[model samples]
Target: MKLNSPSRIHMGLIDLNGELGRVDGGVGVALDYPNFQIEGKESSEIEIDFRIEIDEKDKENLESRIKNAAKNVLDIIGETGISLKVNDAILSHSGLGSGTQVSLSTGKITSLVYGIDLNAETLAKITGRGGTSGIGVAAFETGGFIVDGGHTFGEGKDKIDFRPSSASKDVKPSPVLFRHDFDWDIVLTIPKGEQVCGDREVDIFRKFCPVPTEDVQKICRLVLMKMMPAVIEKDFDSFGKVVNELQNLGFKRAEVGLQKESLKGLLSKLQEVSYSGISSFGPTIYSLGDKDTITEISNEFFDKFGIEGEIISTKANNSGYEIIK
Candidate 1:
């Protein structure tokens, strides 16, 4: 079986403040470009290969995620052999939610090879993903603009502390509160910058959260009042305004504040043309508006700043992943 899954832009996490009894809510959209593509077949033993050329470090990371996911499925189903190959992949830690896409894709293919059916959320739990935000998992499942309800907070609940997904593995995916087809042009600008991960990412969550209650409330109001309505009505103007506003609110503000000055400048330049914000952590910035204008501005920014980066102009993937036999 061959599978193609969409990559997602994690706009921001909402409600990092646990005072309301729930935390880690998220909002994001699924993109059609920069996808995860893999092919799997039953084998005598587990094996993984890559069709596309990738750096050794990236290759190792992809292999580790694929192997771990396959092992999880094997251990659960008492089935042990599958050969998987990565035909395509998105950059890791580029804030594109590539990790979740990689894991879920591998798990889904392994499950199918063993004749076991599993949805993305089930595969995520089994493979230990979707702990902090459901945006990536939901993007893989349904593909659209998605809002996750987050986890119950406090002692003896889904989560008691603020942590990234890698640190909160046992928690299941948060429930999706709303989903709608997002029909706006999206531009992804991934500049060469610090890719925050491992201990640093965890520490950031600890240090900067729980975010201020006022900021979380502002984000909630923006998402509920402006963003949701814009998505449903296909009002690009309102949606773009909210996207721009989110960069300076709640946990997202902290995430953006950590970026290098060059990246910050780049984001500011893009925003002058359209609504722009960093996707998840740092590096991969997304903008919504006319693709030509955004792409042009991105190139100009890179040229003027002497920064190496990638820019992809794409749109929403409302249908999620596709499977082929």
Candidate 2:
């Protein structure tokens, strides 16, 4: 089986207080381009190969994840294995939720090849993908604009702690709060910039958690009132304005502060012509505007920096992954 999974941008984290016994909330959009392509077939044991150039560490990590996912499946049914290859994958750890997409894709294809009848959520449970943001899993199952209610935070199983999504341990996936078909073009920019990963990301969470209640409230209002309404009416201007403002508030504020000074300046420069914001940590900027104008701006950005960068101009995906035999 072959599968194509859309990439997702985490627009922003809605709430982090958890003081009101509510979990973190977030909004995201699925992109039609920069998808991860995977192919799989039954095998005696789990195996994986990436058709793209990736570091040895990434390759080893992928192999381990695939083996673990397959092992979980084996525990469920009888013994089984599969051979899988990531033919094409969106840039990993550049704020594109690459780990979740890659893990879910591998799990889905392995299940399909073994006739395990697994769904996206179950696949995530076994593969440990959606610990915090369900946007990626939801996008895999059915692509669109997605809002996740986040995990519960009260006591016992419901209780949660402040941490990066990847570091949160033994947590179930967050629930999808809202979803709708999104019709908009997104210009994804991945210039060479400082990437937040591993210890750096965890440190950020440690420093910035329990974000001001006021800021979280503003984000919730913008998302619930402005963002959702704009999308329903296909109002790009309103949507862009809301998304652009998100960076100055909530946890995003701290995230932006952690990036290099040059990247911060670059993002500010691009905002003049487009509704732009940095996706996930540093470096990958998301811009919304007309295709031609977006292309020109992206080209100009590369020219100005004189460094090779990727500008993926794509539409918002309306549907989920396509599984082909």
Question: Which predicted model would earn the best lDDT?
Answer: 1
**Predicted structure 1, TM vs. truth:** 0.98
Q: After superposition on all CA atoms, how large is the RMSD of candidate 2?
A: 1.7
In order, the Cα lDDT scores of the candidates are 0.91, 0.80
TM-score of each model, paired residue for residue: 0.98, 0.94
lDDT per residue for candidate 1 within 1-325, as digits (tens), equals 8999999999999999989899999999999999999999998788988999998998999899999999988888888789998999999899998899998999999988878889988998988899999999999999999999999999999998999999988999999999999888788988876799889999999999999999999999999999999988888889889989999999999999999887888789888888999999968999887789888988988898888899998899999999988
Clashing pairs in 1: none
Q: Any residue pairs clashing in model 2, and if so which?
A: none
Clashes of each: 0, 0
| Model 1: residues with Cα > 4 Å off, grouped in runs | none
For model 1, what is the alpha-carbon lDDT of residue 249? 92
Cα TM-score of candidate 2 = 0.94
* 224-296: candidate 2 lDDT, tens digit per residue: 9999999899998999999779989998888777777767776777787788887878568888877677667
- The ten-residue window of minimal lDDT in model 2 covers 154-163
> What lDDT does candidate 2 reach at residue 68?
77
